[model samples]
Target: MKGFIIYFLLSSITGNPLMAFLGVIIIYSLIDRFYLGFLPDFTRIFRRNRQMKNSLKELQVNPQNASATFSIGILYFEKKKYEEALKYLEHPKLKDNETANFYYYMGMTLMKLKRSDEGKDYIMKALEVNPRIGYGLPYIALIDHEMEKYAPDRHIINDLEEKIEKFANTENLYKLGRLYKKLGNKEKAKNLFSKAMVEYSYCPKGIRRIHRKWAILSRVYKIV
Candidate 1:
């Protein structure tokens, strides 16, 4: 009713339907920008960029600071600066850390850099360190699929399927759907996408915040 009233008033004042429609669109976009967050978080991006700059300064102060090096590399990775991320992540000091997270991030950075085989090796090492790395299975499946090594390591697929059954979250469903789609299991993929859509629709708004990216991807898959 409010939208109709606004449109009617705009149309009356402008004496042009298209202009009134455009005005309504602009108003809705503003509302979405401020309240709905359908757009990227510019504030978060700006803060991250600031952190990257600070990390660079910290690195200059202590060039051999493993923590600082890893921090800068992680920030670069999050910003999709894969090559720059590798420059820091590949620092010899990071190898001394030897944690699952270190290996996972290195693998992800390598994958983004198109070093798929090396990425796969690192991801496998990460899994070997801790099979329950929450984000590991999807990447493993993705890398294997990219390498066309279907079922090369059945354990990863089995592990992912098990996790999906255990968690049954929207994001997990969407990830599995993507894996199935990549492997040419269209019917299974379609079913998983449909399931993810239903889960997204019923999920609480606050919880949906975390699943937002997956929800968007699911919608795109449906369209395709």
Candidate 2:
């Protein structure tokens, strides 16, 4: 997927159809061999970790680029390297809205690692720096959702639904559908899920997952 995204980006910049096609084939082959064949999930995670390590090395050589530092931090967080993410993201020299996003993701990583107090501090700092950062709200909602012990809240779910609707991306739509289902709004869930199915059908896994979800909803709600 990453290779395909990179290829597509290059193709967009260079206007080369053959290169884009080659990129698709390369990504497909890699996905088939690794994800569909025999590579363990941990192996994929390790590869990503190594990639982040290399990126961090590059960032160290050019510490003035905030984008590189933030990207490296994001990659670290994605690999669950919370301490490393914090080390880079908490650099006092880094100060900007992008750095605020780093703090938000760091807080989310710490929260996932079960350090709520430290996580809250970082999240508060994120909001202090950029109150309108979209990512921070979702993290807060997640924390609230977790603390509520999985008991669904219509109000919170509704707010998320509104945000997802306003944003209207494939991921946000899928999440909105799930949240609506959790909140017992089956009709709304089905509609959002159908929209997501249409929007994300290019990706096989996403299509399959959405179809399975719709099948279950169909049984439960008689949704056509």
Candidate 3:
């Protein structure tokens, strides 16, 4: 009702119903972008493409532009063009420098390519270089990998729990609970699920949209 009223007011002011509807859409999208975050970032897609093209042009001129190469490769990775991403990401020895981000992106791209072994190696290297990288997402990715193999070790689970305790967030806590549930540790799972909800409760309103799904899901899982 509120949105409809706003739309009606906009239409009346503009004297163009189509323009008013577009304005409403833009307003809603901006709200989601800044406060809700439930919607995907359409602007990022456009920015990635433009940056990729600019980087490609720079590489065409210099051919040894390490910065441009990495930029293009990461952009390709973001675009889900893994094969192409790998080509550029690995083309240079990164001037023989092994940065954490390069390791992580390579691992992720390899994982997407279905080369799990190589991907896991790269991801582990990334974690070894910086345990706190990607806000503990590297640990989450490994947990997911272990799940795929149906052989998640208790050590891995405990390590994730420790890291998650230090960097508690709804996404990581919920995933940790999921890991416990997968291993038949119902009590542990419930504890983690409850923690997830606690973390969500303290989350800032502007960023709550990022965690809302996991918060609601954790509530459902907590009771079960």
Ranking according to lDDT, highest score first? 3, 1, 2
Cα lDDT tens digits for candidate 1, 1-224: 88888899999999999999999988977765654557677788999989888888988898887888998888888888899889888989887877888888888888777777888787778878987665535353543445366536667656546655655677878877887787787887888888888888888876766666677787788667
Identify the runs in model 3 with alpha carbons over 4 angstroms from their true place. Answer: 174-194, 204-224
Displacement of residue 197 (Cα, Å) in model 1 is 1.9
lDDT of 2 by residue, 169-207 (tens): 455555656665776778877787677656555556734
Off by over 4 Å in 2: 1-55, 58-69, 91-99, 114-153, 178-191, 198-224
Worst 10 residues of 3 by lDDT: 157-166
Poorly placed runs, candidate 1 (over 4 Å): 1-38, 136-147, 150-156
Candidate no. 2 TM-score: 0.46
lDDT of 3 at 153: 85
- Write the residue-wise lDDT of candidate 3 on 116-202 in tens digits: 889889988888898777787777767767767766586876676577567789988898888778878899889989999999999
Clashing pairs in 2: none
Report every candidate's CA lDDT: 0.76, 0.63, 0.83
Q: List the residue pairs that clash in candidate 3.
A: none
